[model samples]
Target: MNIKPEGRFQVFANIVMILITLIAIIPLILLTIASLTDNSALIRNGYSFVPEKWSVYAYQYIFSSGNSVPHAYWISLVLTASGTLIGLTITTLLAYALSKKFLPGRGILTFIVFFTMLFSGGLVPTYINYTGVFGLKNTFLALMIPGLLMNAFNVMMMKSYFVTSIPEEIMEAANIDGANEFSVFFRVALPLSKPIIATIGLFIGIGYWNDWMNGYIYLTKRTDLYSIQNLLYRMIQNIQFLVNNSSSLTGADKSLGSIPSVSVRMAMAVVGVLPIVIVYPFIQNNFIKGITLGGVKG
Candidate 1:
């Protein structure tokens, strides 16, 4: 049998894609195996796919405190949900208004939005303003409003999707039929924006879930408000500090039992990313479609 050039090219492409897929998945597999491996085995043999022994000590240490893990997870979930919802509403409304070319002062408004993407007030000023003027310090609102609440990039991405994908002719027809702007937007524009909405929501949700800085900074006085990321980060930091200073300490081995070793850190990482990895499959199709259809247009 003879193979055509196209068939040969397809075979080469499939081989390359399979290689890339394995490259992406191998690290995750190793990380999982390492997390399950006993700490002693991990230290002795380093990370391996097949460890001589397995242990759940790390997971036990993580949940050793009664409800702390669950509480942090709850806080992270709430923050992600609330931030994504509020952010989507504000971004979509702003992008929709900016998509209309005939709106009064549209050019200036668009420029201001674009300008924000280029320059931002430094962190100190932002912190001062949020703490002093907004009184957000040590509050749940502090975590919800700063950083991941909304972004100029998301607004621009959504604006591009609205302008290129949605036609003005449909809006004109709806207007001609005595439909108001609100009705047109609610009934027509939003339904047509599923792909972009899903894309933005996913981005915003991940940002909120993974954010430890906001909790670390603003919630210094309120440990109860810490998110899952913040909690895990603190756990890792404490473990590292103890390990680094173990020699200097008077009773190192006695106290080292409270701290987790390498396997525990890997376990924490696995726990941190588990929810996102599980959820990605549900949104994979929409995420792919959104990126394809929502590209920026010149």
Candidate 2:
């Protein structure tokens, strides 16, 4: 077959995309190298894409000193997993019902959801509600519930997917076969909508993993309930606090020798972000497919 001009253009586009991908990934590669390099060398010589000397001291520090690191890791894992599972389920079911034409009062419900995106009750009122009315302060629910659960945008995405991609005829057939709404949604629609499910799952999972605000606001005084992000936030605050108080904490004449501030901050960032970096690629293809398919039909 003779190659068309369009085919030649596509080949050129692929090469350009490859270059762009490399450009995007180069910084992450540099960060990993810096994380492995000795902090003292990094400070003296400055960071390079290539490390002068390699050490695992950062990782060692994180894992050392009893089981604090392991405990934090477990808490983060549990919160991410549980929050993602529950949030995805609720978002999907609610989105599915709202996508249906016959569902009563969907317009009002959707308006309410969209309204939340535009406005909220502000921080003080929200804090008061969660603490006073809900009594969710300093609990694991505080970490899992606020901010991370059932986002309005994610629900709209799912609703769009169901509206555009799912066939009305197929739903009618399922109803004729004596399947109830719940059965049809779970056994039929949900399975066929794997791409959207995976997409929403990734969104919810990432939100849960990266969230520190809820833990900060509602989880005061509960170090045990901190997420990995929250722990990293506290670590940064502690570093700043030490820097501010160094003159008093140490003798006025003494210096703390820089405290590995930049390197330690970078190291903490790497630690907090490592899991998402590892896991995102596994679902990335599905996420793209979901968004592409969902957007066109909806």
Candidate 3:
């Protein structure tokens, strides 16, 4: 029955992790419960974990508001998928190039990437450039191109992973075997770097999925292009306006009272993030592996 120090430490760590998991999950459980609770109960009791009454009226109000919900879902799915693939491709190519010490202008390129991480052209100029010059506003490109496409952080992480984890001798061997740079990269480098690729892909995917600012700013008149987040945001705004200005309209008081504004807000949160939470567990292993290995210095 004697236990080693390591065994005791392992048990303690498991206990700590289980407690942390509960702390994180309990709020989400409460949020879903609150979302399902009757709006009157929510307003009266202030979000009890176990409310007296339950209702799906919030979700009904949300979906019945317009035909926009399903369209928004499709738009978000396509935007996230396309943006992640394009962003990851660009990131991987740029990182692979920068990882080579002998590449001409490598230092200058690395400096530029690092400098971008520190500075930007400011909001006005960026907005003007993307909208006026590039004519990206009101287009799908607005969502995929403006800011979420690529960035220095992912590039650096991928570059660091390539340089530290991939062996120079292996690349050299491929070259000596008459393989071109493309061949070496495709056959030797990419296959061996699955963890980093999956990690960065997940990062880009989540960013695109959660992005609402792009749609809000660029798709003002292009309401059809609004993603799920943008649609829900607009719904929330409309509800708030109704609640705030209820005194102005003739029947606004009754209308506002009937709306499940309180519970609907929680329902929107659950809807916005539920898909990502469902998908994360599938790639959690590669993501953790990537972060761990890519962070090390040779």
Candidate 4:
């Protein structure tokens, strides 16, 4: 088949998209450079796309003794992995169950799930439940439990994907072949639903990874249980606290100016975000597929 003049337009559009992508990526490149540059150079000179003097001092400072960044990184990794796994499992199962037409009260159950997205108990009640009833405060559970697990939007996304992508005929065929509900789900549906599963997993994982509110409220004393993001926030807080209170605490001889505050803050930002930056591409492929599935008609 001979292509039409519109093919030339498609090429032009592609070039434009490439330009836009480059524009968007420039800041990220600069952030990487700033992370590597020394504090003195950064303050003396303005921000640069390329660093004149490259130093790993900021990263070294974060990893050095008396700093809890390494522990926080480990805590975040555990919480993110655990929360993503458990949350994805529960979301997939619940969404799959609700997707089936024969399941009784599925509509009501879905309503309850959807209701949460629109209205929540607010922060006070949630805090009370986590602290008072669950006693999750100052524990690893506090980091994993609240707001990260089984979001209604993720559940709905999975249900829609399963309904549209996985044919009911295939599920029926599996049922007829002496497969139980669990067997069919594990052997058939789960495998087929990889796109949505990966999509929701990424979303929930990122939420857990970036969460600071849960740590701030629930993990007041237990610095050991702090996630990377929360730890960074606390680090920034501590720096500011020192700067503000240094005159009173340290007297006139010592000053907070000696601390590499600017570089340290930027370094913390880089550290907190680096894991997500590294892991995003893998999940992003499935995330694109998941969104495409939602757009597809049954």
Candidate 5:
């Protein structure tokens, strides 16, 4: 029997997808296994699919710390949700306005928004301004407002989607029916913008969830406000410090020896990414569609 060209291509494509899926999934499997492996075994054998020894000390260390991990998770959740909501609102509003050709000063406004995509104020100036003028330092706003709040790239992406995907005639019809700009956006533009909105929202949510820089720089005294990333980082640093200095410290030897270092790092990786991995499947269809359709088409 001879295979049809389409059948051959389909078989090849399926195999390629299977390989790609394994490539993506294997690392996560290894990470979880390594996290569960005994610390001493990890040091002696390195990472292996079949660990000789198993341990839960890494998780116990992370979780038994008076609800710190869960609290950090909560902070990350709040930050992601709030940042995504506010960011989507601002980005969509700006992009919608910029998409309208008849709007006054449209060219100038578009140029300014585009300019930000290419360049940004230096870090020192940004820090000083946010700290001195905006006064967002050492607060929760420090995490949400500074950098992750919005992106020029996202604005441009949404603008392109609006211009290319949505028809101006439909908007005109809504306006002719006594609908104002806000009503048109609420009733028409937004409903048709699910793909881009979801894509941009996921971007913002991930950024906020993974951010440790804002916390590290701003929350010097507010350790309680540390997100999961920040808290995991601190745990690793503290463990490393104790292990490195265990010889000199009188009482640190027993305490440090009991906790798993190498395994804890792996365990932290699993914990940090677990939420995103769990949620990706739910929005993955929208995410894929947005990626394909969000940019300029035709």
Candidate 6:
């Protein structure tokens, strides 16, 4: 068949897109299959989609961590939700306030915020300040505060979006109609910023959901307060420890076959990440829109 140039190009583009989609989806399929494969099957067949045996033992083992798994999930959910809300609000307010051309000290404040993006007090000083000076250790504040709050880069994205996307005339008209600054910001400005807010919220939410460092550093003495990532890290460590000492374990213990193998680790990963996967599709449109609008424009 003699295809036209445009038809040939369309066919090539479709093939490339399909390939890219498969590349992204294939790993998730493998991850799910590997999680369901029995420990012995994984050991023998190496990570095949069709394994000799299958078991839910890995999931059972993960859940068997007592209340730890559920509690950690709760902590992660709370932190992700609260952190996203608080971070987005603060970022929007700062960005909007700075976007106002007439605001006093706007230039200086923007410069200061931008400066922090380039330089920060090193980890040691930050640790000392949070742990010793602020005494946020072993508290929910440890999980919620520190690195997860109010990113300078996100602030700048929001500020740029405000400056470029929002027309100055809209705010001016609102002001002329007796709208106070607070009313203008809350009613007019925020309603127009859904794209940037959703995008920044997703970034902040993911950060909080996946964060383990804050819990590791500040909640050292409080295992009960560990987030999902922190708790999962400990689980992986415990599994390795058991594997290392497997020889020392009695024969009966081994016969019970309670030790979680490679599949269990994959299962734990799926558990940790499944929620984010489920949530992403809903916001995908907004995420794309936000990124497109947030691009640097000359």
lDDT of each: 0.88, 0.82, 0.90, 0.83, 0.89, 0.86
Clashes in candidate 3: how many? 0
How many clashes does the backbone of model 1 have?
0
Candidate 3's TM-score = 0.96
Q: Give TM-scores for every candidate, taking all chains together and pairing residue i with residue i.
A: 0.95, 0.92, 0.96, 0.92, 0.95, 0.93
> For residues 1-298, what per-residue lDDT tens digits would candidate 4 score against the true structure?
7767899889899999999989978877777788788888888886797766777787787777367777788888888899989988889899899989899998899999999989989899988988999899898888887755478888888888888999889999999998999999999998898888888888888888888988999888988787888878877887888877776785633545556667777778778778988997877888899878944532
In Å, residue 57's CA in model 2 sits off its true spot by 1.8
Better of 3 and 6 by lDDT: 3
User: Once model 1 is optimally superposed onto the true structure by TM-score, how far is the C-alpha of residue 139 displaced, in angstroms?
Assistant: 0.8
Give the per-residue lDDT digits (tens) of candidate 3, residues 120-148: 88878888998999999899899899655
lDDT by residue (tens digit), candidate 2, 18-120? 9999998888888888878888889889989777888777666555623366677788899889988999889988889889889889899989888878887
Tens-digit lDDT string for candidate 1 (1-298): 9999999999999999999999988999999988888888899989999899998887988889443989999999999898989988998999899888889998899899888888998789999999999999999999999854358888888889999888889989999999998999999999999998999888888989888988888997898898999999988888898899999989987878655589988999998999999999999888877777777672
Model 5, position 44, has a per-residue lDDT of 97
- The candidate that achieves the highest TM-score relative to the unseen native structure: 3
Q: Could you arrange the candidates by lDDT from highest to lowest?
A: 3, 5, 1, 6, 4, 2
**Candidate 3 RMSD to the real structure:** 1.3
TM-score quality measure for candidate 5: 0.95
Clashing pairs in 2: none
Instruction: Write down the TM-score for model 2.
Output: 0.92
How does model 3 fare in lDDT? 0.90
